[model samples]
Target: MKDLFHKSLSRRSFLRYIAATMATTAVDWFKIEAMASTVEPKSDYPVVVIGAGIGGLVAATYLAKNGFPVTVIEQHDVPGGYVTSFERGEFKFDVAPHYTLGLSPFLEYLGIQEKVELVKPPEFFRVITPEHDLILPQEDPRGIIRVLSEKFPHEEQGIKSFMSLLNGLLQEWVKPFDMKTISSTHPIMWNLSKLNTAQVFDQHFKDPRLKAVLCIFGSGFGLPPSRLPALVFSPGTAASIYVGREYVKPCGQGFSNALMQAIENNRGRVILKTEVESILAKDGTVTGVRTTNGKTYTAKAVISNASAPATFEKMLSPGHVPDSYMAKLRTYRPSHSYFLVWLGLNKELRGKFKGFQNVVIPEHYDPEDDDKATSACNASKTRFQVYIYDALYSGYSKPGKSTVKILMQCGYRPWKHFEADYFAGKKEAYRKEKDRIAQILIERAESKVIPGLKSMIEVMDAATPLTHRRYTKNPEGAVLGYEHSMDNYWIYRNKNRTPIKGLYLASAWGSPGGGVNPVVRGGQSAFTDLMLDWAKIK
Candidate 1:
């Protein structure tokens, strides 16, 4: 039956089904291919990249390989922004990313597949609620449908239909559709992009618990189903279930280090611990960037992987930015950040939850209420996502030990009071608040997910939203850049190309939005845009 299902629902049939469902006229097969051929340097024009994040690193590596002299400036000591790791005792904990999908293709394209090792978990995630405890299988869309159907037999048809829709959408997305031509080329996606996740789920399902269970991925984006755009949710969830999710073996730092090494191998330079003070512009065109150390590097173009607010409001003079662009930027809201608690257990947890990388325990089944509680920083009411790194990878911790991390979507407003002091090294008050919040999360996890969780700790560390802001320099410490709301949908958001000439955005704050996969694509897109523009120079 599974073999028959695969044969019946071919790519052509999927497209046909999607076209009929959306009532679109036709599906155009015009794909935007990246210019992979190398070009000789016409002039000594170099490119300056701000931020050494994954996006910037990807862009710089490609540009340098294609005969462009590239230099990346990063404020942090390490290259990876949020995709980094820290050591506590003998254990290493990933800073942000738990597991990522769609990164293998990027690593393969960049010829760094062998440099990094990716491990896929047995399951995508385990969702736990008061009423249901479900496991979403990894790389098995049909299994997901079957599992959910068995759980809620009444909504079986709806489950199949929704999963099928998602499978079709994933196909369209992986085709690497041109963002500019997506509306006309893929009308189904364009239409879906206009609606929220909840609207799409409501159309197919009747059970609120089923919808809630399916909406687990929404928390990863820091938005509930009611606000997260269908375009983001549909393909993201599909990819995790179908294409499969993977984690960089050891930690995310290895992934970042590999990319940085690739860039250096291609003659790109990365300067760490240097902040880009301003993006120098003349005659409304970006000329170069000046570091906070009073050093200036002249380049023909600049790609900023920094936050949108920092790029426009802090890094550039007001006169350089058009009022209209600033207005649109102001209207867009950044996504919620997170407060995390990392604990190193003296005893191994592999015997308890085998092969489970992530386990989400939600206090309430309703995602809307979860979002509200999270935004309010009410730890008791919000959900807790626990990551058992040791369960997935054997070497994640010391012998007979485990590394666990618990986090939830937390708003920046609640941590605003500690921002100034936190960065100034006067963390007395900040530490008190963060510790208090961490205790709440720890206590909740101890009672709900892991019994005697507190007693197993050998090392403990915590980070607040303020810590996120300081490390990544993101506005409000947004985890996923701008919120994936209808107001800030991909079509409405700023693309890789900016209003100012020779300036581009190549980070989560830019087009294609956030997540490890999208940001890697964003980096490639920014590089493609810059290369295309440079081609027009002579």
Candidate 2:
């Protein structure tokens, strides 16, 4: 039924249809008008969101739905920030990981799940090492245990204990906390916040291979076990992968487009290619923003979806932010970025690969060593994960073709010089370095796991840290925002509220860390803060 309806109408059209339908039927116009009359002032703009990333878009949509006049300013020509897609000939590939978990609640909160389609991949992922190849199942701890036990019969009890911990931690995180009483000494999350990922794993499992498998979970968040906070990494990542039905769209474009449509349907404005030069404020209260295009927009409040450093250091004057806050932002450690290689194949490779996500892990995989090694670009030292969209959803590629993405761990410092060199008449060297790295990665994949992968590639493009920085404007190309370490969890994480009144942050830099779903939730949290302020207004 959904396929037929979607076939007849586009996602944007369907969103608009629902918006019109709700306006006429579902919503009580009288109550809305009464609320507006009682609370809303005669202001041209009440909220201005900077950066049209998922977080900013979600916030804008929610505020606009509640009758607040909102405008979103994005420097990119498109929305979604890192959660976006691109097309090359017959292929479409997602820049970020294609699979996402914990969507139902978020979609339900937005009341748009019915308007969007999500494709669930068959399993979690396939982990390939030199000695073992294991296919991990999703949402089934027992199944995972059974499979791992078959590989190492003696460690069955260890596997069971680890699985129990994963599930237990997940439950602990989902428990609601009382905001009024929540503090550093809060019983609910204090111990978890103090624990690191490696410490918990070492205490539970003795098998090195088992520990390696678990460490990969932290890699997904761009952290190593030693540095990753147990509370944030264990429960958050487990909830995402093992506690729910996992799903992904054909690509991220539809999801991004749908959010944009939802915002417009709610009467919010999204201005693309307009860079916000500085956040306007007076007496420590947000007034509006000035854009690079020489236009000033006024609003009662502001939400920043850009990185914390970008928001505080670059977008505002030094006087507007406190020295303590500036020092904190400077000292806060950012997470590792990624190097991606996108491929368009002639035909579906799933018959041989047989998995949606295939990871090529080194036999001597050490999370701490790999995490340190990513500080520089080296193809041989890097681990790679390959995503075959055609394995589950064929729409990402043409009729018989497939779309594959290879993501490698990388740091921003190695490619930092490329940008400077480009302007200094050394464009050839920059291009050559990127091409050389791409070729090396391709060869490495072909030799290690997927043979004939080079011949299958019809279109290819590579993105370094510099490429990500160029497009997303993330300082230092830090894709996952602040590092999810012991020091940056719960009370230590950046809060939505700033010292400046009417200013808030809704990005990966804030609490709960990065990823499409978490950032979307971050946006929702920011919206709640905005609503509280609105409730207190005259």
Which number leads on TM-score?
A: 1
lDDT of each: 0.79, 0.74
Per-residue CA lDDT of model 1 for 1-538, tens digit only, reads 2231355455455444433322111222111123324345524768999999888988888787666789999999999888999888888888986577655555766789998899987687787777667787877777887788888999988888887677566546534467789887777787798789989999899988888788776668888888888887886676566556788897899999999998898888999999999999999999999999999999899999999899999999879999999998888899889889999999988767743644454645788888888888888888778888876766667789998898877998888887777778898988888888889889887766788998898999988788888788898888878887787666575688999999999888897788876677678778777767765664
Q: How many steric overlaps does candidate 2 have?
A: 0
Each model's Cα RMSD: 4.4, 7.3
lDDT of 2 by residue, 34-86 (tens): 44455556354489999999889988887777777889999998898987887
How many angstroms is residue 34 displaced in model 1 relative to the true structure, after the best TM-score fit? 9.4
Overall local distance difference test of candidate 1 = 0.79
**Candidate 1 collision pairs:** none
The candidate 1 region of ten consecutive residues with least summed lDDT is: 23-32
Residue 460 lDDT in candidate 2: 98
Which pairs clash (backbone N, Cα, C closer than 3 Å) in model 2? none
Which lDDT value does model 1 have at 65? Answer: 69
